[model samples]
Structure formats: C-alpha cells, structure tokens
Target: MDPGANWWEALSAIGTVLAVLVSVAVAIREVARARAAESALEDERRQRLAEQRRGIAALVTAWAESQYEPSPDGTHYVRRVIAHVANESTEPAFNLNVVLAYGSPLIQLGPLSIPVPIHVLPARQARSWDVSPGFAAHSTGVGQVPTDPIASISFEDSRGVAWTRGYDGKLQEGGGHQAISPDSETGEAQIGPLDSPFNPIAVVTAFHSALESATTVQDLKPLLSPTATGWSALTNEELVALRDEHAAYGLAAHVWYPTPRIAYVRLIHDDDIERARKGDSARALVVTLVFLVGKGWRVFSSGGAVTEPDWIKFPRKDLLRDLRG
Candidate 1:
C-alpha cells in the first residue's frame, strides 16, 4: 500500500465526518427553530385573550323596578319591570339595541325594540326605561327576569353578537333570543334561568364534549375557569401528550351538576399517565373531574382515581336563591 493512497483515504474519511457534523448541526438548529415558533404562537394566543377581555364588559342590570306587593307570607314580589342596559366597562358600548320577544297561547307579543342612536353607553352609565307592558315576574327576589314571561329581552353587544340571559343567570350568545313557547318568536336563541342553555353543568359538559370530539384542545379553552391553574390549560407538551394518548383511546366524559354552585365531571376513558406508566389504559382516571360554579362554570381541580373519587364526598350549594313562596 502506497503511503499517498492511505493519506487520501484518511482525508476522505475526515470529509465524511465533517459532512455528518454539519448535517447534525443543521438538524439541531431546525429543532430549535420549531420550538421557538411554537413558543411564539402560544404567546400570541395569550396576548389575544388578554386583549379581548380588556375590550369591554356590558350586561343588563337586574335592579327591580317592581310593581307587585308582598306575598301572603310578606315576600315582596317583583311583578313590574324596567328592562335596562348598564355598562360596567371601561370601553364605551355602542350600537346597542334591545328587543323584546314573546309568544302566544303560552304568551303573547309582536316583539318590541329600543335602539340607541349614536349608540353609546359610557362606562358606569345605564339605560333604564319602563320596559314593562309586562316583562317576566319573579314571585320573589331582586330584579328577576321572568321565566314564564309573556315576553323576554334580547339585546346586541358592540361585537355584533346578540345574547339573552340563561336559566343559570348567565348570558348565552347566539344572534337572538327565542321567547318562551316559540310560536312566532324564532330569531336568535339563548337560555335563561327558567331554561338555561349552558349552565355550570352544561358548560362543563361542553368542555368534555369538546375533548371527546375536537381535534384541538384549544376548543376547551373558553370553558376553562379563569382561576384554573396547572394542567387545566395544558402547556404545549401536555397538550401534545394528551393528543397522542387520546388518539389511542377515544376520550369520553360527562359533567354532572350536583348543585347549581358545584359540578362533578368524570372521564369515561383517557390514557392517564398513571395508567400509561403501568402499561394500561383500562383503569379510568380523572381529566379535570371537578368544577365549581364561579362567575361561570369553571374547572376547579382535576385528577383523581375513578375507583374512589375522593372529591365526590363534597356537597353542592345553590348559587341562586328563589324566594318565591
């Protein structure tokens, strides 16, 4: 063997090793770029959410402009109503319109409407007009929208979304609200306290429903309680793991309302980490299994054994008090 030939072979091997090192460096760079891109995306989402919440807040006030006297047991009933709008927001509310929807046989109305020209309600301002040909009446309690009213109030937000109060006393968003006994009243629809469209129980159920049928966990983001921490809003890694695991075993869950103030949720199936470590998905596990009704129904805490859900021992409280005798 010539020494020169050996030198050429050695040079060729070194070149090959250098090429391999370059390829490795490029691969590592690409991975870092991908991670940075994901981090930026997550940051953008959080920023958008924060900005949206900071936009504006508006709701119809529930101050009783009542006309009814006390009950036999001396319970002051709210029969008359003054449907009004209040802006408890920093952002001025514009393009406001309140529509009244009613039904016949069960109720009666042609639908009354009130519009604000140059429509704007300054922060801490309110619109209180005698909206009572007859709004709904609560036999008892504060400014209560009637469940069995001849007509119901539907209104629009500056965001171009129409909403009505739900049975759970939260606003439900659609385009319009359907009055009780939808005979001729069918425009937009939402729930009310008499028939809540998305109660704490329902909101929790919808969250699980999204997990059961959604491609992205972000769909469950809106349902998460504002106070939720840790895994409630999963980080990128947790989300990926869940997506991978859930693909293997179709996830199913249900939210049960033990009380208006509390909700209990349980996962029927999921690839829980404990089970995965044990090489089994047979045992059921918790996926945000408990919810308490805060301002809205939100995930209080999650993760418990399906066999013995220690959290189920708690009691539920009534969020709304019906003083109707």
Candidate 2:
C-alpha cells in the first residue's frame, strides 16, 4: 500500500473518533439541560405547595377560633378544628403521619409525640383531624410527614384568639357569671330581697304569669315595681321593640322564686342559649326583693340584666347605680 494512502486512512479514523466524542458531548449537555429544567420545576412545585399549606393553616385557625366558646355546663370553653391535607406527588403517600407538639395550653400525647391517627384519603380527597376541646393552658404545633422522603417541612401554631401565632394565646373565658350557679342559692340572694321567697323556681313562675298577662307592654309594667330604674329606662318604643324582638326569637320566661329574697329565672329568647350560655344575650328579667325598715320583703328590683364581665367594658355595678340615681 502507498504511504500516502495509509496516512489518509489514519486521518479518517481520527476524524471519525473526534465526531463520536462531539456527539457524546452534545448528548451529555442535553441530558444536563433536561435535568436542570426538571429540578427547577420541582422547586416551583414545592414552593406552590408550601404556599397552599400555609393558606390552609390560616383557614383552619380561623375556623377553630370561631367555634371556640364557653361550655354551657359552665365548666370550660372548647375549640375544635379539622384540617385538609393534599398529596402533591405522583406516587401515593402511604402510612402518612403527622407530628404534633403541644406547647402551652396544648399538651402532647405521651410516648410517640406523634399526632393522633389521621385517615388517609385519595390523592385529591381530604381528611380530617381534631385538635381539641384543648384547654387554654398551652400552645400547639403541627408538622406533616410523608412515607416517601421529600424536601419540604413546615409547622404552625394552633393557639390564639385570632388566627396568628405568638404570645397572644389567651385562655377562653366562660360566659356565665362565676358567682352564679345553676343550683346556687347564695349568689342569687345578693341581687334581690333575701327574705322573699324568690328563688329560681318561684321567680320562673312569677315571670311566666307576668308574660301570660302581658297583652301589651303596659300590662307587663305592673310586674315591675314603680321604683325599678331598669324598667323606667325603657322607653315605650324600646319596650315595644323588646316585645317584638323577643316574640320573633321565641323568648319565653321561666321563674324560680324559691324564696322572697332569692330568685332565679332564665329568659330564653332562643334555643342557642341552652346550647351555649354565651348565647344567653337576651335579658333574663330577674326580680330581686330586698327588705327595708318600714316595708317587709318586697320586689327590690325587676328586669334584671346580667352580662359577661369581660365583654362588658363598663363597670356593671356603676351603671346600675347611675340608672338608680
């Protein structure tokens, strides 16, 4: 073979090797570019999911606070909540669990420090988990865990009157007066004539009679003493308004006049009050009798009004005095 031909052959082989190397390099670059795009998409997806989770957390917090109210048994206030979790990945999450930390009023369950078992629904379906009737003693935190490993973790505080987390966590208050009880007679005596047989049962009966007799506001006027400042405060228009409002709301009076001095009656305007004492916004129209030097036990006062001290900013006793004057 000619030397020149051999040299040309060697050059052709080198050119072919170089073309192969160039092709391999191009393929590697394409793979790298695809991988980079995929990574960016994953990051974007994660960010969106995090944002959605945050929004859900906010909504859950609001729902919880709205439901929180004083228990009617007057023992405590309760807040209950349900949260929805979504599966963001293509693979189904298996045995998914949540870790909950109870900080202050929120106490953690022992051993696992894990959240209560939450039912796993389908990818788009939702599941619910109850956080409490949790007491006002502690704060709450929750974290989500998926069986398959992923890079995102977030947590939120579940305590506060409003939907934000931080030092604002306060104990929810009971609605009824702490001084009064369903069966309590002593506290009932303080408001009315102690010597009169105006206990809860008696007062309820008297109010019922008054309500039955009340064809007009004027007829009901006789049940209240002439000296009663509360009744006097009501204008004729206001009285008519009360009657109308009460009638619309199904207001009914029950008196428990056990003794002349102590009386207890519930003026139920709606069924809401029985569900929660906080709904007892309707005036109870209590009548208390106090003894005087010249007079024996008589109706000390009528149309009694009681409000939750926390909600009522003004001093009720002072207001009462001003009305009397």
Q: Which sections of candidate 1 miss by over 4 Å?
A: 1-40, 43-51, 54-65, 69-80, 99-113, 116-118, 133-168, 176-182, 185-325
Clashes of each: 9, 42
CA lDDT of each candidate? 0.45, 0.36
Tell me, by TM-score, which candidate is best: 1
lDDT of 2 by residue, 161-182 (tens): 1112222322122111111122
TM-score between candidate 2 and the true structure: 0.25
> How far out, in Å, is residue 319 in model 1?
42
* Tens-place lDDT digits, model 1, residues 245-273: 44444222222223323444444354453
| Model 2: CA > 4 A from native | 62-164, 167-325
Q: What is the C-alpha RMSD of each candidate to the true structure, in Å?
A: 25.9, 19.0
